[model samples]
Each structure stands twice: as C-alpha cells, then as structure tokens.
Target chain A: MLEKTGLPTDDDLKKVIPDKERLAKGAVVIIECFQKIPCDPCAISCQFGAIKPFKDINDLPQVDFNKCTGCGICISACPGLAIFVIDNNYSENKALIKLPYEMLPLPEKGKEVYALDRAGKIVSKAKVVRVQKIKNKTNIISISVHKNMAMKVRSIKVEDKKNEG
Target chain B: MKKTNLAIIGGGPAGLSAAICAASSGAKITLIDDSLELGGQLIKQTHKFFGSKKQFAGIRGIEIAKNLLQEIKKYKNIELIGNATVTGYYEDGILTIVQGSNGDIFIKLLPDRIIVATGASENMLTFVNNDLPGVYGAGAVQTLMNLYGVVPGNNVLMVGAGNIGLIVSYQLLQAGIKVEAIVEALPRIGGYLVHASKIRRLGVPIYTSHSLKEVYGNDGVEKAVISEINKDFEFIPGTEKELKVDTVCLAVGLSPLSDLLWQAGCQMKYIAELGGYVALRDDHMKSSLDNIYIAGDVAGIEEASSAMLEGKIAGLNAAVSLGYRVDNFLELNRNLRKELEELRANPLSEKVKIGLEKALLKREVDQ
Candidate 1:
C-alpha cells in the first residue's frame, strides 16, 4: 500500500560505487532532467563512480562538484534526456556548460539565444559555442552555455518560442 | 494434420486460462506460443499487477505468469507447443504452426473447436532518428531486462505517457536504468494518475506538450532532442530541449495481430479504438466465420487479466457450440464472462470496450 503513493527516496545508492567526480576543485555542476520516469542509468553511468542513484531509479542524479572531471561522458550516456557538463573555469568570468541538443535548424555556431533554467526561466544570454548531432539522424545537438549561467541554465530557447512557423 | 477436442493458439494469459478452464471440464487442449517460453508478455512484466484477488492483484506479473504455467502442467490433456509460430489457418480447424528448428511440419488437426488468442504487437512511432539502435519498443526493453538481465540502455528517454510508457519507465528503474523523462504530446498524462504520481514524487518529470524531434548516437544512441508541440502536433522552435541519452524507448501504443483470423475468413472491421483490425466476435468470442474463435489481444489490445477471461469464454462456448454440452458448461461460462465484463468495466478499458461493441455487430449476425 505504501508503494502506491510514492517511492522511498534514497534507496538505490546504499552500496553503489561513485562514477562522476569533480576533476577540478569547486567546479560548478549542471544536471538536465527532461522527464520523470523510473530509471537510474545516470547514477550508474559514472565511472569515476562519482554519480549516485541514491535510492530509486526515478531519483534525479546528484553530482559531487568537487570531483566532477567535465569529461561529458554522462552527458551522452543519460537516456532520460538529462545530464550536462559545467566548467566554471571557462572565459574570464562566465561559466560554460555543454548540454545535449537534438533539435534542427541547427543553432549557428555564434547564434545567440536565451538560456533557461530547469523551469524554463531565462537565466541569461547563451551564445551557441558549438552545435553538432551525435550520430545518424539524431536530433541531440550539444550546446555550450555561459560559465555564470551554467549552474542555473538547463535548457535553451529563442525569445517568443513558437512552433516553427 | 492431427485431430483434437480443442486447439488454443498463443500460450499467454488468455490462451493458458482457456486451456485451464476447458481442461477442468474434461476436454483435451493444445496451446501454442511463439516464444520458447509459454508465459507470453507477462514474462517481460516485472511489476506486480493490480485487480481483484482472482485477477492476481499484488502479485508480480512474472510470478503470475509462472504460477499460471505451473497450474497448466497438472492438466494431463493440455498440450503446449512452445517456440511454434501459428503461420495461418485453413478451413474447418487446420492450424498451420511453423516451428523454428522443426521446420515446416504441417499438422492437420480437425479440432472440435478453435480458440485464437494471438495477442498484440507494439505500435510503431515515426520521428527523426526513430530507427536508431538505441531506440526500442518498450516490449523489447522488457525482453532485454526481465528476460535477459541487461539494461536496454544506460540513460533512457521514454516517449509517451500512456499506461504502457509509465509502467515501462517504472520497470526500467527496477532494472537500474535512468529514465530521463517521459514526453507526452498531450496536455495531460494519458495513463492512470496513480502511476504518474508515483514517478512524479521520485523526481522524474513529465514533459507534456513535448514531442521528440531527433535522436543522436554513434553505433547505437547517444542523445535525444525534444521540442514542445502545438495542438496540431508541430515542433515549437524555441521550446526544444536536448537530452543526452543512449536509448529512446517508445511506448506509444499497441495494435492487435489478427492475421490468423483474417486467414480463417472471419469478417473484420477497422476499429481504431480496439488497437487495429478486429475479428468480429460474439459474446462467446466466436468470429463471423463459423467454427473459428478469436480471443485476447488478437481480438483487441486489452490487458492480460481481461484476455484470460475472454479466453475462457471462447474456450467454453466453443466447447458447447461443438457439442460438448451447453447445459453443463453454461454456468461456468456465465461466470467467466461476468468476470471479463467486470475487468472491462474500468474506465481504462473504455476504448477497448467500444471496439468490442463495434466488433459485436458483425458477430451478432453469426450468432
């Protein structure tokens, strides 16, 4: 009956190994979660063993910023449309985060767009540093965001976002 | 060709149930399933089922399938052909089953009655990069994890918020995979609120009004991009979200596999609600073509619980129609039918029941 209401939090990583860790000390962390379903690939995908499932497969991945290497392997390994790489060391003051992108009309290398937070809230300006598809016919375009906005921005969108007219 | 008292095709819940009920009535039965194992789709189901006690509520689906198989073993008259595919059907009651290793061994059986519980297949969805290896049908994942003990992918994106999608997402978690999120083009979660709520509390987000635009991967899948869609189902330009993941699982829907019924010359109608083309069948599940019966998912993409009930209905009524004794089987058949009606009464089954009613019209003429 208890299982009917909700899942127990933090039950999946009791004895699990950590896969993702902070390679550079005090590096920023950015996690992109697309939807909610039962899964834990992200928690187990980290080889530095830095990531933790923590409990249920449905739980969101919590990263240890002190140990993250910014390798971005988990960025491509996550299936829920989640995971990203944040480098606070980018530029003079701005942070840079690489995210999974799968849309078309490929954002130009220098194109400017609004960086949005987890709730689609605009955090700051995001310049398209790089955009490329992962493989044959994949819409997953990886995008680079500003260093300062890296921790806050999890998504990208143009102003007055509308279905392609 | 071999002759028998009853011939049941597809050894899933529906077929097995019918075999059990009919065997209890002192009838010899032959059950066939395509999988080397007889449990059918239930084997891929790792979650516990919900329903009344008789329907196996609170029991894991795999355990339920195992229990059903174990019960069938006690029946001396029940013959199960695993790893055999029912290719087609001939006039009267000749079922052509093609066994993989055995080659084409044609068994011409003049059975007193026939029950076709062929079940359903996963509905395919079209999207850019949908054909990638990282993309899979929910059933395929179930097969890999539940049966093979390996995750379909590391991080996964599930498209569709229907019952199948939601249930599979939950099951994927059980197998220790990351379900990034579920994207539903619709405004509301199409599945039960309870299911949605379960995943929601665990921090999995549901992205409504979102549709997949593309998937990126090298040899398999590496990433997915989903964009918000308008009511008309077009991608929104500024609303795109890129998700890095290896696999994209589609649980869009299911459609009935009614080919054998068509081969038997049963009258059919395009009933979209029932998941696809359906063999018009009476309450007893006898199709328009005389001496042929259709039951379970093959009749419509209903749940295993209901399919089992329908199987019993077809088996029992087919027995009576073939001169097994109407007076003796009437009570048992009535109970089975009632159980089916209850299971079909849930709101979740409205679409299926509508399809059943549509299929009933053509069936009435045959009755």
Candidate 2:
C-alpha cells in the first residue's frame, strides 16, 4: 500500500503507534519507518536508550515508549524524516506534535499554518509553538493542533501572502 | 616521469577513501581528479546519507565530502592533484595526465600500483525533443542548485522515480522551486518508500506506470507529455497527459565509467545489473593485471557507503602487494569485507549483490 500511494497504510501505523495508556501518560516518540534499509541514526542518537540497539544495521528502529521522554532530539537525525514526537496530554482539547521541518523560510513561532495529513491534504489549522534550528539544517518545528487530529497531521504549509487567492 | 607507490584516479568518495587507507599504511599515494574540487558527486549531494555510523549515516553528503578531504589532509604521504585528468593508461605501465585550463600541460606517472575509481556517468532517456535546452540530468540539477546555488527553473517535470529523482524533487522543494510531478515507468516506486513519502507529504504527486512521451518547445522546454505504460514499458494509447513546465530532469540510471580499465586490459563483463560493463576483480579488488586494482562504481554501481568500503579494501590490498606493512592485515581485511556484506544485506541491494557475484572473479590459487 505504501509503494502504491506513497503514503503509509493504517496497518503500518498500527504497528508503531503507542497504546492508550502511553498516550495518556505524556510525550513519546513514534518511528514511522516501514521498510528495512541500512539506516540507524535514530538508534544512535537516542540519549535515553529508548530506541534499542540495532542487532543489524538494516533492522527497523524499535522504541520502548516507557523509556522515551519525547525530547525530540532524534527527530532531525532521521535521514528519511520518518520520526516524530507527539504529546497527547498537552491540553484538554489540543495536542503538541513535533516534526522535522527542512524547507526554507522557517515559519515564525506562534504563527498559524495549515496542518496537513499523511496524504498532504489540509486537515486543520494549527498554530506553531516552537522552532528549533540545529546545525545540520534539519530544523524541528512544534505545532499545536486539535487532540483528535494529532495522529493525522504530519506536516504544515506556511501560507504565502503572494500565493493567497 | 614521476613515480609513486600508488596512483588513484578520481577524487570522489572511492578514490579519497583509497588514498586515506593506503597512506595510513605508509604508502605514497597520488590522487588525481578532473574537477577543481575533490568530492566528485558527493560535493553536490545535500541530503543525509543512509547507513551505519562507519559510513557517516545521517550526515549530509556534502559534509561527508568535507570530512574525507580533511582526513586526506592528515596524511602527508597522500598528494592531491585537482583539475587534472588521467588521459590514458599505457600498456608500458605509464599513465598520461593532462592538466591546465586548456589541457595543454601533460605529465606521465609510472606508479607501482594503480587503483581506478573513476565513478559513473548519468544515463539519459530517449524521447522526442529530449535534447531541448531546458532538459537536464539529475546530476546536472544537483550541481547547479547545491553546488553553484543557481536554480535550474521555476517548475520541473521529473522522469524516473528512483532515489535520485525522489531526493532531487525534495531538494527542489527545499530551494523554493516547484515540482510539477514525478513519472516512473515501473508500477511501484523504485526508490525507498520513505523518500517518496517525504515528497508526497509535501504535496508532490508521483505517477507510477507512467513514462514521458515527449517534450515540446521552440527554444526551451515548455511542456511535457506523459502516458501510462504497461508491463512491457510500452505506452498506453489514449492515456496521455500534458503538464506545463519549464524544465525536465532525467534520473533513469547511471553506467560505470570503466574506460581506463578497458584500456588497461582488465577482464570486463557486461552486467546489466551492475549498470554496464565493469571490471572483473578478485575479492581484494585486484584486477587481472598484477598491479592494477578497481573500486567503487568503476567495479560496480553501488551506494557511496559500499564504494567507501571497496576503496578501503582495494587500497589495503594494493599497499600490501607493494610490501607495505599493515597492522593486523587479515583482521582488517575481514572486518572490511564483513561491513560490506552487512551494507548489502538488505533486499534493496539484491540486484547489486547479483551483479557483484558475476563481476567478482575467484582466485585459482591464493596469492
């Protein structure tokens, strides 16, 4: 399904998503990597040992949700940009999602942007909460969206004034 | 004529790694490259590499080039010659090199050992008006944008959805350029699903089972016509779609640049899986010729990580053959081979593994 549409299927997400108790607890990391490729930066960059050591370099990353503090350090380290951190307990009706942002002209903190789902459709309007730029150019952006849309929203589109119709 | 222990042609990842490895064993190495800069294609790669830490995974290719150059600088025995192209490898054991902006100067070297890591060249697609002024290869696009900081065009129609196409499409978006679409002949994307997902989530559409029918323009590219292809790669009638775009990028594939090897009289085999004709070499990267070695894409088309490992193997063996002392030679050789095996263990590398099997020659007797 992923090869056909270029979007991970629901079945793929079910294997990596944290359970209800872990979601209710606090922030945690979710690795969306599906295929086996020779990549291990997520395992090497984890400071808390949440991501288990790879027996082989080609093994997909497996994270122990209980050990993960959702610090978002490994978000930018993923070469495929397939890692994210979500805090379902951010507020009564809102959740915080930290995703890798690599496009130019970084959106300002607290700016409102269109939150997009895995299929790249605008699902809801979200507010940018934090913008952390690291030396490697893969910046980390934190956005606040409705609690129900947390899992669906995976990217953002900064509304350009010139492109507005 | 000047002489050295080893001469490496091409200052790309493969040649640079070979120089570092051989120089560490106290062998005098002369590394030559045609480009003014030393990194070859690695200099233009902006995306992070995928592999373990030994290959600099998670680091950008541009950064890896810098690191390799820095490593080469620490070894005083390795001399770098940039903007110099090795013209021919003579049967009399002499290599003719042409340097200078106009290629007026000529120099000859008679090294005890030679390691050819000339890399590969991009393959072009055949379609009507494909030679238009605006048409470009994926490597050209990367060189223009990542190296020279010049955007190729406002909008681009990409052909071939392999890793190069997908990564270039993402890079185009990063540079604030618009990607019209990506067309691949295969029904499924040939690149990693994650790379496709990266651009898909950014609002780029990848059309599978589609091939570029043609491009039309007076002086430059104005539009592209694409149609769905069947299992045999033939276009399906009445399924044509036209897209408005200014540029077209071809990322079909690459063929090994093994001209020097052919000239040097190394046993060659035409392996389609390896991208083209590649030199047959032993486990240690030694060619049929006693003092000649091959590594990287020159031996077979593979990822930069594998190229680096091959360069290490070739360099170590080349130096050892020249009677240079290396600490724990067998252990080092075994570890390098094991790392290479691990790198190619994934299913994605199946094609490369098969190609390597055919290109690798078995020793009749251990030297």
In terms of lDDT, the best-performing candidate is: 2
The per-prediction tally of clashing pairs is: 55, 0
Write candidate 2's Cα lDDT for B136-239 as tens digits: 99999999999899999999999989899999999999998999999999898889888999899888889999999999999999999999999999999999
How many pairs in model 1 have backbone atoms within 3 A of each other, for residues 3 or more apart or on separate chains, i.e. clashes? 55
**Interface RMSD values for the candidates, listed in order?**
12.8, 0.8
User: Cα lDDT of all candidates, in order?
Assistant: 0.70, 0.93
Candidate 2 residues lying further than 4 Å off, grouped into runs, are: A161-165
How displaced is residue B91 in candidate 2, in Å? Answer: 0.9
True lDDT of residue A100, candidate 1:
60
